[model samples]
Target: MTGWLDRAAENAHKFAQRNPRAVAAGVMFSLAGFAATAFGVASPSAPGTEIAQQIISEDVQPLPVHEQLEALAAHQLELNRSTAGRANDTADRLLSRLGVNDASAASFLRRERGVRDLLDGRVPRLFTARADESGRLKELVVRMPAERRDQITTHFTRVTLHPAGHGGWKVRREQAQLESQVRLGSGTVRNSLFTATDEAGLPDTIATQLSEMFSEEVDFHREIKKGDTFSVAYETLTADGEPITWNEGAGHLLAAEYINRGRVYQGMWVRDAMGRGAYVGMDGQPKQRSFLASPMEFSRVTSGFAMRMHPILQTMRAHQGVDYGAPVGTPVRTVGSGVVDFAGWRNGFGNVVEIQHDGDRSTLYAHLSRIDVRKGEHVEQGTRIGAVGATGWATGPHLHFEFRIRGVHQDPLQVAKATQTPMASVSRAELQQLATSARTQIAAARSMGAVRAE
Candidate 1:
């Protein structure tokens, strides 16, 4: 019997070697069955057996009143305030308004020449101050326009005052570079362009650019009806992330869209290889015409080129030119690039300046307080040749602008519209990309304006 058992074991070992995978599967099946049987036979608890639970409660006590008061006293807060310097602002008054009662800071501000200069300008300067809980000034900063005329747009002046190592004070005055920030704005014309821009918080410079951008399509002076809308994306110069006041932080107008009388106009700024940039339509055509509709940057048309009662003559006569009502000394520019044909006092037109352009076209600017150009001088479009004045046979300050074709009087607005805007050869792909970006920005600005209105 022992020999027969040994022979059977030998046979089983040989079979396992021949079929290893089958042997492994059988072993796993047997283990699973064993586990199922063990679980099935597990003993059950006694009938009606139950667990127990108990509730616990206690009151938490805070620290003593004196300890709490000490903790509160250890944590002191600092306050910051900012305001613009007023014309009548004294050191003490300014400090008081900023919630600082420190006499030393006020004394320093008055005693330091640099600090006093920061507050001397008629235009307000931005002032920022920091103080402790006891109203003691810890730091003061003043920001204003750069003193250099060439750097006003590119730089800003910063004056700082703080406590030194000791109880004394340290002052610093420096010029910092201005940073350009891209901004978007949109508005609707309810009354006038200025009023709409004021409501929209847009800079006056940008508002003027918008008018110039679509001068050929619409007459901003007379044809701007109610319900007209516009959107703009522009660059604003900032000093340390704060918008500067001088020049209203004026920069470049990047892109603009205007809707007037159910007509839509859009333009995007495109630069050439020479680094010169201009506003162009989505089709890669320039928008700036050779002539501008208005001689001045922005003004109202007091009289049109038609029959009107002469203020001085007191007789109905044909008004050969358009009269623009503006304040005295308002800058008057040449409508188109040309040479000064005449620059002097005339019979009815005082301080007159006539510019002769190509194609037998000439423009006239009269009633000037001062003449900045001379006869035979070459002047470009938008060049300030003189200023608005009442020197001519006029009752008030205004600009008399006229456009002549072959010695014949023509409407200035009409002439501007008829003049063709020269288109420059540009890369179609580049212009299309720029126009696409401008469209996105303009849409965002419009949506933002709608949200604000809501």
Candidate 2:
């Protein structure tokens, strides 16, 4: 067998060498045939049988649409900017401070009769002025108190000074409408009344109104503890057909309630037969007393009304009034409606004000930097009387407030509480109408998140 295999191999090798090209061609053809058979078994369609073709479409243009431009005036798009300033004593000084460069407008306003009356007032009038691009005073407006010879309408004056095309201004005086809207808000005191009200989106002016409304009843500074809550419905002015900003032209507190430390204090605003508004309770009793508990809006009782060692004199003495430690220039207000019996420097009190209220009642404010009222001047309740200071016999800036009756000094806080009058419920017929109206308004307000602007 071995001899036969060897003879066969030798013969094959010899044959391969003689026909190498034919041998290589035969091997390639065998591999190609095997691959083709394997691929052909899995093929879905036979190649070169018939290739399918699809039709191609040409593009077309879109349809046209017509349009036109709207016309707008250049001046209409431009806004007239203004700056507000308080008028000084003289017209020249006020014009200088207000940056009014127009000599013609200045001369016209100075010569105008209405302008002079509007400018001259006990308190400096607030004026708003506007100038054109060339720095010429184009308009000047001052909101003055309306002078009504006969009518009892709630109105004000909008005195406008503008160009008349005759090289001077035409002074126009128009009746300004003092429109008002009722607004509502409720808040819980977490840190402070101001903080909570601010968080509730209430204005500071309204917050001040709330404090004043409940001033005689609530001790907002001390008695107002955590978890105390309050709700208020008040009027906000819409002045001269313009929207009232948060700080400008704040109206009065219409109604309010303060729930403090297991006690509830309520106030409602109502107009009497004479159309005079007063804050009362739901039962129709006056919420306001003869005097407010405190004269300073925001203060701390650093030194109570008692015997204490005088800081400056270094001696034991009776501190007849409460000493509220505050920064200088804090506003001091009158506790009640009264006349300014005295507003000047005293022996120990710096800029002192003595207001004599009804029924021989009086209140004293001392240690003031500046006095705002003069002697014999009638001031309303909560009117600013002076600014806090360290005037007179004091070591630092504070308000020494005292409540006196018939020339006898008493504890201000105690006097405030004692002055509260017993509230009497209104008649059933009258109560039904007022309560229904109030409830309806409050419910409407509660359902809304904010006051709707007109």
lDDT of each: 0.68, 0.59
What's each prediction's clash count? 0, 0
Worst 10 residues of 2 by lDDT: 33-42
Stretches of candidate 1 off by over 4 Å are: 1-77, 165-167, 270-277, 289-351, 354-430, 449-454
Instruction: In angstroms, give how far residue 307 of model 2 lies from its true place.
Output: 37
Model 1, CA-based lDDT: 0.68
Please tell me which predicted candidate would have the highest lDDT against the true structure. 1
| Best by the TM-score measure | 1
Clashing pairs in 2: none
lDDT of 1 by residue, 1-454 (tens): 1232233345445435754543443421111000010000001132211110000000001123224334644653247777788888889888888889887888877887767776675865888888988998888888888866446666888888897745578988899977654566777788987678666667766776666567667777688779888877776776765667777675656678888887998886654433244557767778756677688888999988776799899999989988999999999999888899999999889789999975456899988999999999999888999899999798999999998865878777645543434235445555665677677657656655554444
After superposition on all C-alphas, the RMSD of every candidate to the true structure, in Å, is 27.9, 36.5
Q: What tens digits encode model 2's per-residue C-alpha lDDT throughout 1-454?
A: 1232233345445434754543443311111000010000001122221110000000000011000001222342232433333434556666666666677776766787756765564532456676765557777777644555122135666778878787966778777655544455665688888787776556666676577667678867677899887766665554443334423344555567778996987766554333334556666667656566678888898887666798888999877788888999999999899899999999789889999876446899998999999999999999999999999988889999987755767677655554444223323444444545455434333323222110
Model 1: colliding residue pairs = none
